[model samples]
Target: MTTNTEPALHKSLGTLQLWGIAVGLVISGEYFGWSFGWASAGTLGFMVTAIFIAAMYACFIFSFTELTTSIPHAGGPFEYSRRAFGPVGGYLAGFATLVEFVFAPPAISLAIGAYLNVQFPALDPKIAALGAYLVFMGLNIVGVQIAATFELFVTLVAIFELLVFMGVVSPGFSVANFVKGGWSGEDAFSLASVPGMFAAIPFAIWFFLAIEGVAMAAEEARDPKRSIPIAYIAGILTLVVLAIGVMLFAGGAGDWTQLANINDPLPQAMKLIVGDNSGWLHMLVWLGLFGLIASFHGIILGYSRQIFALSRAGYLPELLGRVHPKFRTPHLAILAGGIVGIAAIFSDELITFGGQTLTANIVTMSVFGAIVMYILSMASLFKLRATEPGLPRSFRAPGFPVVPGFALLAAVVCLVAMTYYNPLIAGVFVGLMALGYLYFLATRSRRAVRAATAV
Candidate 1:
């Protein structure tokens, strides 16, 4: 299982596969996560926060593309930061990626159970969720092409489903419904609502949670220097359109209160307009499965690669990095992630401590990872630009210092906001991160000692 260099992941992903990887990793966000934003900040408040977050993501993606294309490493952020600031930076970046990619899918997996519950009332969602983990991981273990092709297929169906949803729900769209209690019953400009806006940042983030996962597939892409940037740019734009459309239509079709605290927002909206027995409601309940599966399966692909990368670099257990000789896939890494994801499903109820459900806390922690990775990766970009001016570049970030600088600043602000408003979740997330980083240090120390003893 120990590898001194990158293990061969089949380089079969072309531009469409790369695009599917990016969009599929994030399509579920448009379906469910954003609803929690309404609970936190009201409709308009979430929009305000979401707009700011979207701008930050655009900047981050542009900057992330430069790093991924130039470096073209499966380790994604870890590889970039390691090159710039060495081991400490690399560990932090990789651990953050774990938090983002690993934690996020379980949350979505739970949502999958919730979706299935609509179709089969007798089935326990948690058990269903655990089953999903087994099925998707099995698919992932078989090979990358099979997994990525499944991702592309489901993502297209999900996208078409979204457009049909927009058409079905659009007739009932209303500014009045959307702005009903738009401040969550707080005074419109009051200081009280400010924290809610900050808290909603995590959920709004769900709208594009794993779009950066496109970079995780860089190692497996053909002509990544060109394909990677194309996938990222197109993926973000596609997500933006879908996010706004789904939010406006769903939020407007029903009471914001009804939509705010549910995982099945689109179907709920359809039920409101078309009634429970309507054909459209049934369409939503089933086809909506594609959106959830797209993200659930794609993010699995992303997390396994991050785990494989970390293990390959000797930052984690070597056994977790092994590629299956026959499948040419990171078999152990996918299995390990699947195990963690199942455990997360059972622990999903542990975070209802302060009016925050397990899903809310999980979403916050994932965003915490995204923030940490973004800040460090942007800093690493700046460091590399200054230290290695003559480095070869196939693609330079469009706005250069300004884009990365803004992305870093935005991430810093979001970090402070999340910590200030949701201290419990933030504290727990930081503690987990510290433990991971310490493990990396201890592993390095032992390796150093062994090398010296041999000498």
Candidate 2:
């Protein structure tokens, strides 16, 4: 219960709405991005990577729920780390969370634009991406209830569409298709496949990347102690099932290679089964936008809250902490994050490194931030358990020590794997972090001097 003078977030979100936000924050992965893993590891190898990532998420979310319930702040990992380790720890967590939330939306927005381009051949995907930013930022600013409700609707539609896709493609699914050349160009697992599996770590992570973002909304949850655990537990379960189902079904529907490296794999897989002009294929292209929209919109919500939280704590400029007087939303924070996302969208073609597009690079960079934050958040959980034994926790993580320890270990392994596989992106992530840290130190020193003068 860290109190602040800034306007508070509205408590309109319940368990179901929180569940929606949790799922919506990550549903886009079910649409695309994860397919790139196939290019690295093939279907079977990627599946193993995905399952490992899912287990990490399951443990992380269960453990993270205790922090969310006991502390219940919009800063999420930032608040937890700050409580555990002080200002520098808080700054690192906040910066990483900001990077994760801000960069994620651009990737999803570009995907939204690509999905739109399939329907409108002449419309520039960049323009569509910018338009999406404007629309969703406005929606988020107008009100949280409206935004959360819309998120729930789109998330439900997105889930239904995924189910529809699996059913339609099930008839075409075959074990032979899925396992053919599945292990990094071999039919069975071998030591040679390990590199591909490691290479595919980032994509496997994409399957459940932003689910922890639900903690960012804990301050707005009506009954966080009870609602959060239920929402988080259910949300992770739902996403794990969908991620596995979508990957397996799509891979088995046709030549798995055809689905790999493509943004709209579901439609392409369906086209193989039902012909090019099948209504199902067309429907998937159109309705699939809901998945992208859900993630894009929900991430806007997440980034704004993180920005607001950090600013309110004096980690960022005070202007961004202000809630809209009428709307009770972090309007400036929302707009600030939107500007960053739009800039990334516009730079899609301009920013290329190692033959990867801005979206691909940013996705890796975002995962870099997420893994760092996960490690710190788990560390904070362990620290607090030892230091603050009296903290009220409505739900404790099952199998503590072992569970969260596994999560921490997995996150560290993922970070090492990603850095090794994506050296350029890793460098960029580190560079940005260094710049942010410099700013944090400068601002903190100034604040300390001012406090000393007053004393």
Candidate 3:
């Protein structure tokens, strides 16, 4: 079979840059979205859920590294599933990844707008969100090295700001404040609390949603086999610490309920310590934008690469596959994803359901996509291990069946919980996937006919 020829992405990323991409893609979760879990699960309940979700990510990343190092494809899970289960599996994985990478940005962009609104209360958040999409999309189209360098800078600053937040709020930290209404309703866990904890699964998963996107950069990494494992391991450890620390300090600062359901949770938590006019609060509002920007910018890089790979493989429009000749980046793919995000930003008020804003709904939808991709990717690992035993693997998944088994089982539980709590949004996700599958079937049939006619 003849394959499509496409321009190669420049190979300029090293371990540090790849680590930046991996962590930066997810750092924003420490800023805002996860706080919503407090609304459903409260402090103690959410913490329990977060720990479970964190363990699942650790297992998933460890096993996922094996596939990334073995194949080193920009398609990531899509390529792995295709090799293991053929075209149908590839289509499902690719579409799920696209849903994840594409939906996540609008949420981050809205958070960026919310942060900017803290600095300039009169500015409309949607307009600021639109501006963010424009600036970062242009940056990503310029070059991979330039984009990765900027991601590293912002990620480091974001990490520093988080540490500062912990230090500044440490004086007010009290175990009593954190444990008040710790469960969903009452102080202690009960049958009622279980539903709330399950409903909070998506919010907990948000902390590590796009971390797997690191695999999308494997093709552009220098010495991918060595660097991919290092980046994935170090990146997860960094995020897990920051996620737990930030959540604990913020919850203890004041009434945890006040921080729930808002995009500027950090600034609000800081305001409880220093007055609203204090320099510390203002500083957080300013530097906090870097965390949102890092994820916003990095995910744009991620989604574009997914689009480029799928298009190059004859799954999406060919225009999206073309790399810019001068810049050697996926220009059209970047712009295409940006357009979808901008439209979602405009629909912020229109898309709400169950009293949650567009940001929360979008976050749930993105988590749904990520969980599905995790299941398929783990299944691919088992299938490939059995069928292609000779495939060169620089790094092997430790405990093989046990580790991947736990990851896959956890992902299934999360999916069931999310679908139950979010029936409407879940339906929308299913509808989108069904539409994409129809396109895949139509194009595939045409390709088969053309190949036979030429023969």
Candidate 3 ranges with C-alpha deviation above 4 Å: 1-4, 446-455
lDDT of each: 0.87, 0.90, 0.92
Worst 10 residues of 2 by lDDT: 446-455
TM-score of each: 0.96, 0.97, 0.97
Number of the top-ranking candidate, with TM-score as the measure: 3
Residue-level lDDT tens digits of model 2 in 36-84 = 8898899999999999999999999989999999888999999999999
Per residue, candidate 3 scores C-alpha lDDT tens digits across 1-455 of 33444469898899999999999999999998999999999999999999999999999999999999999999999999989999899999999999999999999999999999988999999899999999999999999999999999999999999999999999988888888998984688888888889999999999998999989999899899999999999999999999999999999998899998999899999999887899988889899999999999999999999999898777897789899999999999999999998998888556688778889998998988899999999999999999999999999999889998999999999999899999998899999999999999878965465346552
Summed over model 1, clashes come to: 0
Query: Model 3: which residue pairs collide?
Result: none
Candidate structures ordered by TM-score, highest first = 3, 2, 1
What is the number of backbone collisions in each predicted candidate, taken in the order shown? 0, 0, 0
Q: Candidate 1 on 1-455: residue-level lDDT in tens?
A: 22344468889999999999899999999888789988889888888898898999999999988889888878999889988998888888999998899999888988898888988989998998998999999999899999999999999999999999999988888988887778755536677777788889889888988898888899899899989888999999999888888878887897868877777888888888888888888888789999999999999999999999888777889788789999999989998888887888888456565677777778888889988899998998899989988887788988788988899999999989888888888888889888887787779975454335552
Winner on lDDT (2 vs 3):
3
Task: Give the Å shift of residue 44 in candidate 1.
Answer: 0.7
Top model number, lDDT: 3
